[model samples]
Target: MAFDFDLFVIGGGSGGVRAARTAAATGAKVAVAEESRMGGTCVIRGCVPKKLMVFASEFGAEAALARDYGWSAEPGEFDWKRFQTHLKGELDRLEEVYRSLLKQSDVTIHDSRARVTGPQEVALADGTTVTAKTILVATGGRPVRPDIACSDLGIVSDDIFGLKTLPKSILIIGGGYIACEFACILNGLGVEVTQYYRGAQILRGFDDEARGLVAEAMRERGINLHLGTNIVEMARAEDRWEGPVPTASDAAMSQALKGAASPLARREGGAHRPGEAGPIWVKGTNGQQDVYDQVLFATGRTPNTEGMGLQDVGVKVNRRGAIEVDAYSQTAVPSIYAIGDVTDRIQLTPVAIREGMAFTETVFKNNPTAPDHELVASAVFTQPELGTVGMTEEQAREQEPVEIYCTSFRPMRSAFAGRPDRVLMKLIVSQASQKVLGCQIVAPGAGEMIQLAGIAVKMGATKEDFDRTVAVHPTISEELVTMKTPMRTA
Candidate 1:
């Protein structure tokens, strides 16, 4: 049988792009199809733009700190339009860079959505079919709304980048990092931010003490943090969305009950038409009712494996739409494979790229490599950032006895300014092996620090190794090496 190319990659995300370029280097023909932009999520929407916003949002606090440091400084009004213009330009440049990389590798770029038609065939959104020796599915995921009434009245994280103007006030729903991070970002940018979480704590699944400090920091910064709270009813005012109301999957869910009796109920309009621009009416779980300029939903994300012909072609898809794949990134059908968020593996960009590299090695280089997911480091860009690598204290104790060393205090810089801001540094070590099992830092620049700390943890550095290393004088990170006693043993 003849094929159009040796490989057909269904997404242009970081994972698919890397795999296509690497596989093409092996003297194999490759083609990548993307329905939207060339750089997919990270470069186009998720990390790149979000990080830029994070940086922009921090300037207000930085300026205030400058004043306290004997420098005349004041935070002026933020011009969101100006910042958004620059953000768009930067994203455009990155997309071009991605296209250049693929072109250099001699890989074909199809600007269309694609799906598996058969074991060796793929169908594009344009009604064109292309056959290949192997097909790789790397389409990532998207934010999902909860099954609540008038949910479409709320926007998802992705919609944040596209907003023309920043709202004066917003109600963010969800306790995850996305919701919490945005709550801080918007508050820093001078928006009145109120967060509602259904759970008892925010940033669930993280170290409890670390998240507690983050929540406290958020509250100190004026974020209205509500725990064990959710929206009971919501609707848009009659005069909203002056332009086109949100539609399709973006529309808020409209339930049958309009004038339902509820303690928290407030009705300022007859009905809501998806995508309209009037103020949003809300009834919260605590019997509080009010109007908000915007309501953002960061509840969760789901894999992008639906309606793309996967199940029709006998490819297995889980209930949540994630494609099931082996350690080698191969699917049940020998010629088909999936990786990145589409597989619901690690859901991180770096992890996805690693999986793609491993797939290239196994399939093209004959190296038979599998991605190493252990000790993966990550950061949350909250007001006071959090960086973590390795196991949590709870997880470590469940596996074996462990020793924990931790510290919390106001750092020198903040202390000098008489600010109440404090930072935390923690280390988890195995009692028997004495090896550093995990490290977590909660403070500004924690993300950058974790990258270096992660290298030591990955090498299985023991407590003695850290003790012998000379400490940098007058630094927060020096605490990592200087902690002499286990605060507690688990």
Candidate 2:
């Protein structure tokens, strides 16, 4: 069948762009449509900006630590406006790089939304329809606020990047990495940060010990973290005061009302509007009521498969709105395929790029390829940070007999400064085969450490193999190789 192009990608995200560029390199005509800026979540909003914020937030502590190390250093105030201005410029430059890369590969770019209109056809928001020999969906996902009263008054992870000013106080909802990370970031940035999690522990589904240490570190850093707690009701502080005065049971509410009326909550002109940098009164499930300068909902994220005409064209979508694809990322319709967050398969940016490359290989190079999903290492940028790969100790014990080698202690740097900070290194190993089943580290730069550990684990390195490697002394990671005995065997 004659088509407008060999490939038409619906998203200009990391996955879609990589696929488009790689496919184009194979001498195929490729076109990509992106409604928003290029580079998708990782470059535009998620990783790049958040990491920069993480770096910006850490300087205050770094200056303090420097003073303890006998250096004449004084901590200073953070300038949100100054930092934000630079952040915007960096994102703009990255978006241009993405556009240039696609153009360099001779791929056409459409700055509009697109959706599947038929098996081999796509319709853009501009009322233009194009047919392709293959259709690739990489629309990615978006941060979602919970369905609740006055939830719109709260911001999501995406909105954090665009905040005009840092709030004096913020109530971050949810226990996932996003909530915890922002709680730390804001707290570090000199904001009063309170976190609520309905779950018993934050970072659920991660190693129990690792998450416990992270939660403990969060509390130590002055994040008023509340577990097994959620918001019962919330409204703008002004609206709350329109009713009768609070009773004695509402002492917390009264205190919060006073805070709302404080100069810190009010601006030069007037109090900010609801959903802006305004005071929000929140009633928690635990009977605590308070007003915060900002409320952030990091509840979850959903796939971007809605109104895309996917199902009508025989592309199956799951109940959670994720596109269903086989191991090779091909959908039910052979002519159509999906990858990245839209497929809900390993929602990491690198994983998405890998999937895109695999798709190009299978479709263009005539070499069938499936992106590997096993032992994918990831880091949660909480205060202490968590880097993990492979099975959790809980999961390993349930599947097979395992031995656990674990250790937790204050690192040399933090201990020298007389800080209470402690780091963790744990390994879950198969008892019978002596293979390292999992690796988890909770420390500064654990993200970087895990990438190297992930390589060993991915290569099926056993505990003995690690023992054979000489330990690099005076390092937190040396523990990974030096642990001679199992802390526990199951």
Candidate 3:
């Protein structure tokens, strides 16, 4: 059968865009379809903007710490609307860059939603169809909102970016990274914040010490930590009382200046309205309908497998609707493949991008592609933040004979700032081979630290190597290089 292109990607996210460009650069015809912005979640809503806001919000906390830093400046107010305007402008500029990449590579960029009509053909939202030798579903995952979260208010990571202003007092639900980051962003921005996690702590999958420090730092910041709490039900100011779950409710989520939470709950849902995003009432595990200005379900994500025509082509999806892809990112149907959050395998943006590029190289250029999923670094932008890679002390003990070395101490700067935040560091080393099994950190710039160690852990660094590395005086980072004793031996 004659094909219009060598590769046709169904989503224009990190994975799809990379795959498209890489394949085209290798002289294969490529086309990509996207219903939303060019940069996908990272640039558009998730990482880029989120990190920017994190920096912006940090200014407030730093303002307080400035006095300790021997620099004094009066506290200033934050303009969420203006900040958002700037963020959107920057994002639009980045989108243009992505567009330029596709043009430069001569890859067709179709700004429309796409679905698999069969193994070879993909139908765009505009009813245009394209045929290809291989179809890639880099379709990213969608935010999973709780069954009942808010009525006319509340927000998700996707919706938070478009908010007109920040909430004065925010009640963030779930202990996931998103919830923790939002909590940090808001609290750092001078919002009286509270975080509710059904689990005992935030960043559930992280090491025990990192989780402990993050949780402790969060509590120290007056962001009322509500752990192990269940949702009861939700209520609206106008609506009458009801049973466990209420049908009519309003949810308002605000970030700054303009406050909009589920229908006027905290500090009145004034200026900071949802813009186009509204809130709904949510029933909590407490058996009481809790009404908050902003409610976030950072619980998890579901794949955007619907309306993709994948089912018709026999592309197998898990019960959760995630595309069932193997380590090589191949779907059940050989002609079709999937990557990124769509497959739900270690849902990191970098992972998805790598998988996409690898798939392109292996199939088109005859280059072997298989990524070592181990020793990949990840950071949760919580107050102090948590970064981790490779195995946890718990995970490594089961298989590899290992020794666990860890330390928890107030970061030097925090000691000066009078903030009671502790930086926790740990390394898991295999006793048999003397190779580093894992590395973790709970501190500011943890993302940077973890990535540096990721290379070492991946290359089989030993405890002796870490010990031999010279410590850079008294810095948060020195904790990783200077740990002298083992916390536990297997």
Candidate 4:
């Protein structure tokens, strides 16, 4: 007899695992395939490990501050090698926990990659296949590498978490949320970090005021900001591009194909690669590339859909390799669906988990519901941290008349801590109805605190509702409640 199941989830990421487990709970047989560990990207590469590193880096600054707080100790150094090992141990434990949970729930764990072989059938990387009543793609996305001349010079978010040692310096090459957070994490830890954005500003999709202010704060922190500039061109040409060693032959070929310069520059103050411990050359846009021990890439994520036979089943994908799905996560091939980063809608971990849950209720339980995505609040665990919910002041003004109220001030703690970093909060309200159109927060723990506002904003809270709430005294969050006059409310 051929074994069959009610649901088969491809890509054992947060969304896929969640959907599988939830479906299994409904007395449906479920099978989940994963080429990597369980726990998905958030657990393995994206958020969890990145945050662990962020927390580790913050201690470097906090140790110095502890003296000001009257606590003193013999200053030690950070061991990047051991930290990586510990992080790996933690991730392994978490992955085991996820696998155990799935097993206890009796969900079949296929230890391989899965692809949509047909409408309701999936082919595993091992060549065997599974046929189910429905298929779910939760493959998630991965970091994208650039096409610079120094192929060895580039790195991505995926490669940073497993770093054996903390870098002395880094150049992050994106303006998106990922790059911004990494710049914060790296710079806060005392690494000389530089950010390169193609536009005149960073955080392109965010509000204008918020974007401008964050850039200022980043600059204040000594983050080398190169705005309105792309990598222009990078090469191993030592004389032109800066580097410590000679260019690898393949690197030279790549540069030649791109028409980049060929004068490989000499090293500055002498540098060596850690592993091979050899002189390696790299070129940067400044025409002055220093020999650094490491490079952390923070560009963007590509949905993990390659080689995962999605199109074989007639599944639709956008130009960016993100799976195409309707509001209910339904694909053109009705029986096969996708959620989370694979769908490329809202690529947050919590959003993926929610979409997974919603999918199970709608399909297996027959509830037929859609995941709520409006006013979804998210945070970036940067040095000051950032939290945001609802629309932005700019986004609100496009539709109708909006009122904008923005405030920038140092929080009370900053006075004592003497940190130049300030808190920024903004609110967008509709002129006709006084409804809160958007909310943006830039401060410590902004991401953690924004969840409360997220609920209210999703429920269609108005600016009046914000006013109704009494201000909590001596707190940074209270600024949201105490907006006096509008800067520009549409």
Instruction: Please tell me which predicted candidate would have the highest TM-score against the true structure.
Output: 2
| Top-scoring candidate (lDDT) | 2
User: TM-score for each prediction?
Assistant: 0.93, 0.95, 0.90, 0.89
What order do candidates take by lDDT, descending?
2, 1, 3, 4
Residue 461 miss distance in model 2 (angstroms): 0.3
Every candidate's CA RMSD:
4.9, 4.0, 5.3, 5.0
lDDT of 2 by residue, 1-490 (tens): 7999999999998999999999999999999999998999999989999999998889999999999999999887899999999999999999999999999999999999998999999999999999999999999999998888778778899989888778888899999888889998899999888899999999999999999999999999899999999998887665666545343224465575644532223213344443483667788898777878789999989999999999999999999999999999999999999999999988899999999999999999999999999999999998898999999999999999999999999999999999999999999999999999999999999999999999999999999999999999899999999999999998
lDDT of every model, 2 decimals? 0.87, 0.91, 0.77, 0.77
lDDT of 4 at 71: 82
Superposition TM-score, candidate 3 onto the true structure: 0.90
Ranking by TM-score: 2, 1, 3, 4
Better of 1 and 4 by lDDT: 1
Off by over 4 Å in 3: 149-153, 240-291
lDDT of 4: 0.77
